[model samples]
Target: MRRSFAFKCTLLVIGWLLVAIAAVQIPARTFWPAAFVALTLPVALGLNLAAALYWLLRNWRVAALPALVAVLTWPHFQRGLAVHPLHLAGAAPKATAGQRVRVLSANVRIFNVYPQLREKDPASPDKMIRWVASNPADVICLQEFYNEPRPSRHDGRLFQSVDRIGEQTGRQVFLSRTLTNSIGAEFGMAIFSRFPIVRRGTITFDKLTQNHAMFADLRLPSGDTIRVFNFHLQSMSMDEKDIVDSYSSKAGLKAKGLGLLRRFKRGMVARSVQMDTLMRRFEKSPYPLLLCADLNDLPYSYSYDQLADHFQNAWATVGTGVGSTYNGALPFVRIDNQFVGPQWVVDDFRVHYEVPYSDHFPTTAEYRLK
Candidate 1:
C-alpha cells in the first residue's frame, strides 16, 4: 500500500508540473503569475525528464506519459538544447555571394567602456572595441553601444568606436542614441551594414529606461531589400553582486529574496509590454524582416513566444548544444537572439562562448533571402 501511495503522489507531482509548463504559454499581460511560472520551466523540464527516466526503469507504462509530452513540445525543448553539439567557430562553410548575409549581434556592455570591465584583457586600447571593428560580418547589430567622438575627460581617450567600426568594416551605420553625455559620449543601439541603408527609424518605449530599438532598410547587391530590426529590451538589471548576495548572504535573507522577486516580476511585465509594442509596429513591415535582439527574457517566457510566433528563431532552427549568450553571474541564460521572417533561411547560428570581453557573448547567424 505504501509503495502504491508513493507512486500515486509522484504521478500527481508530474501532472502538476506538466500543467504549469503549459500555463507559461499564456501571456504575462493576461496573467502576471505566469511570468514566474515561466521562469521555472527549465527546472520543471529537467525534473520531468528525470521522472520519465525513473518510470522507464520501474514502470514502462507510466513512462509514456512524460515521453508523449516531451515529443509534443519538442520544439520548445530545442530552445535550450540541440541533440547535436556543432562547432561554434571555424567550422561552417564560408558564405557565398549575392545570396547570403552573415550577421553578428551583441550587447558588448558598451565595449567595456569603464576601465574596471576591461579586467579580462587590460590594455591601452580596449580589445573588445578593436575586435568589433575588425569583425568581418556583413551586418552587425550592437546594443549598449558607446561612442565618444573626441578625447574625453572621463575616460581620457577618443572612443570613436561607432565611426571606427563603420570605417573599418566599410559598412554604412545607423545609430539610435538613447543617451548623450556632456563629454560627447553617446550610447545606444546601432546597426552597421555593408549594403546601402535606404531608410531607418527608431522605436522608443513608453516611460521606460534607455532600452530601445532601431530598424534599417538595407538594399542588397542582388537588388533585394530587407528590414533589419535591432533591439535591446527591458533588462532585470540584476547585477553580479545582487545575484551573489541573494544566496550567500546570511543577514536579511527574507528582504533580499523579496527584492529579487520584485525585480524579476517587474522585468517580465515590462518586457511583455515592450514586446506587444514591438510586434504591433514590426509585424506589418514593408519588407522581409531580420530581427536581432537582446530580449532580456528567457525562451520560456511570453515575450519570447511573441516574436517566435512570427519569426524563425535562429537558435531553435540551426543552433547546437547549449544556447546561452549571457556571460555573467547567470551564465546559462540566453537572452540574445536572431529571428528571421518566413522567407529567410538560417544556414548557421553560433553563440561565441570563446569571447569573454563583455557581459554578453556575441551571436552570429548566416541568413539567406529565399
Candidate 2:
C-alpha cells in the first residue's frame, strides 16, 4: 500500500512538471518569469519520456499523459536534435565561383586571458589565433575580442590581434569598444570581412552591462551591400566558482545558487529590452541583414522566439542536431547562432567543435545572396 501511494504521488508530480514544461513554450515571460527553469526544457522532456517508459512497463493506463506531453513538445526537441528521414550519406551544398560567402561567429572568452585557463595551456592564445586564421571565412564576427597595445616579444611592436587577423585573412577590420581605460588597450566586439566595409557603427544598449552589439555594412563583389549585426547580448555573468566547478559547502552552494538566479533574472530582463531595441533598429535597415551573436539565452525563451520568428535560423534550414556551440563545463547548449534575412539562402551551417581553446565553439554559415 505504501509503494502504491508513493507511485501515485510520483506520477502526480510528473504530470505537473509536464504541464509546466509545455506552458513555457508560449514565451510569455511576464506571466511566467522563470526563464532559467525553461532552460531545462530538454531535461524535462527527457524525464517525461523515461516516465512514460516506466509506466508502460508497469502496464499502467496513465502512461499516456507523459507520452502525450513528450510528443507535443517534440518540436522544441527537433530544433536541438536532427532527425533525418533516413540514415543517408550527404554533404553540404558546395559553392560555385562567387556564389557563396561564408560567415563565422564566435565568443573567444577574451582569448582565454585569465591566468587559470592560460596556465593550463600556455600556447592557447597562439593556437586560437591560428585556428581563426586557418578558417578564413569571408566575414568573421567575434565577441570579447581583445587588443592590448603592450609589445609582445613574439608578435613584436604592438599586441594588435585585430591587425594580425587582417594580415592573415586579408580582410578589412572594424572594431567597437564597449569599455576602454585611459590607455589605448581595450576589449570589445569586432568584424572582419573580405569585402569593403562601406559603413560601420555600434548599437549601444542602455543597460549598464559592458556587452554591446555592432553592425557593419559590407559591399559584396557584386556591388550589393549587406549589413551584419554582431551582437553579444547581456550575459548571466555567473561567478567562476559556479562555472569551473561545484561549490564545496552547503552555504557556498546556496550563495552561488542565489547569485546565479539573480543574475539570470537580470540578464533575462536586460536581454528582453536589448532584443526589443535591436528589432526596432533592424526595422529601419535598408540593406539585407545577417545577424550573428552569442545570445546567452536559450532557444525556448521570449528573446529567442522573437528573433527566430523574424529571422531565418541558418541551422534550422540546413544544419543538423543540437549544433551545440558552448564547449565549456556546461554541455549541450547552442548559444551561438547565425540568422539571415529572406534575401539570402543558407547553403550550409555548422558548429565547429574541434577548437577547444575557448569556452564557446565557433559557428559558421555559408550563404548565397539572392
Candidate 3:
C-alpha cells in the first residue's frame, strides 16, 4: 500500500512538470513566466524520464504519465539534439546553378575589436576576417559585423572588411551600418552574396538598439531569386562573471539573483515584440526565406520554437550532437541557428566549433532550392 501511494505521488509530480514544459510555447507577452520555463525544461524532462523507468515494472499506471509526455514532446526534443550521431549526412552536393547553394552565418563579435575577448591576440581578428572571406560558401550572413569604409578618418580604414571581403570573394556586399564609432568605425549586420543583389534593406527594431535584421533578394546565376534574412535578436546580455558572483559567498544570493531575473524578464519581453515584427515579414515575404540568426536564447526558448515550428531548422533535419553555439553560456545552449523555407532542401549543416574567435561560434549550411 505504501509503494502504491509513493507511485501516485510521483505521477502527480511528473504531470505538473510536463505541463510547465508545455507552457514554454506560450509567448512571453501572454505569460512572462513562460520565458523562464526553457531553463527548467531539461531538468523536468530528465526527472520525468527517470520516474517513468523507475515505475515501469512496479506500477504501469505511474509510468504512463511520463511516457505520454515523452511521446508528445518528442518532436521538440529531436530538434534540440540529434541523438543519432553516426546517422547524420555528410558531403554537400556540388554547386548546380541555383539548385545547390552553400551559406555561412556567424556573429563575429566585432571581430575581436576589444582584443581582450581573444586574449589580446591582434592577429586573431585579421585571421577571422580572412578565414570568412576564403570560405567557399555562396552566401555569408554575419551579425555584430564591424567595418570602416574611409581611410582618412580612422586607422581602422585599412580593415574595411566589406571592401576586403568583397574584393577577395568577388561577392556583392549589402550592409546596414547600425552603429558608428566616434572615430568612424561602423557596426551592423551584413549579407555577402555571390549572386547579384537586386534589392536590399534593413528592419530596425528600435532607434537605439544595435540588434536588427536585414534582407537581400539575390538573383542567382540561374536567374531564380530568393530572399535571405539576417537577424540578431535581443541579446540576453548575460555576463558569465555575474553568474559566478551570484553563487559567491562574498555576495548575497538574493540581490544577485534578483538582478539576473530582472534582465531575464526584460529580454523575454523584448524578444517577443521583435519576433512579432519578424513573423509579419515572414508571412508577407514574396520569395523563399533563408533565415540566419543569433537568437541569444537557448533552443528550448519560445522564440526558437516559433521559428523552428514554422520553418525547417537545418540542424534538426541533418545535424549531429547537441549543436551548441554559445561560448560564454552553458555547453548545451545553441543560440545560433539557420532555418529555411519549405522550398529549400538542406544538404549539410555545421556548427564551426573550431573557430573560437568570438563569444558565438559560426554555422554553415548547404541548401538546394526546389
The candidate, 1 or 2, that scores higher on lDDT is 1
Question: Scored by Cα lDDT, where does model 2 land?
Answer: 0.75
By descending TM-score, how would the candidates be arranged?
3, 1, 2
User: Over the stretch 1-370, how does candidate 3's per-residue lDDT look in tens digits?
Assistant: 9887877767776776776667768888788987786667766766767777877977797679778877777666766666645435445343354577889999999888675766857677777898899999899999999887776443444468988778667999987888788867889988999988999988988764568889999887667889999999998866777866777754556667788888888898888888888999999988988999998777777788789779999888778778999876555778899999998887778888888888888999989998
Q: Which stretches of candidate 2 lie over 4 Å from their true place?
A: 1-34, 43-74, 84-88, 91-98, 149-158, 207-209, 243-255
Q: What's the lDDT for all of these models?
A: 0.80, 0.75, 0.81
Clashing pairs in 2: none
Q: After TM-score superposition, what is the CA distance of residue 228 in candidate 1 from its true location, in Å?
A: 0.7
Judge candidate 3 at residue 299 and give its lDDT: 76
Worst 10 residues of 1 by lDDT: 83-92
- List, residue by residue over 1-370, the lDDT tens digit for candidate 2: 8548746755765665665555444443354365656666666666777778877777567678677767876766665665542221455444464447889899987777567877878778878877886786999999988776666555563346786677657988898876665656668988999999999988888742347889999998888899999998888777656844435667766657677767777878777778888889889999999999888877766677677767888876776667788776566677888999888887777777788888898888789987
Stronger candidate by TM-score (1 vs 2): 1
Candidate 1 at 313: error in angstroms? Answer: 1.8
Largest lDDT belongs to which candidate? 3
lDDT of 1 at 369: 85
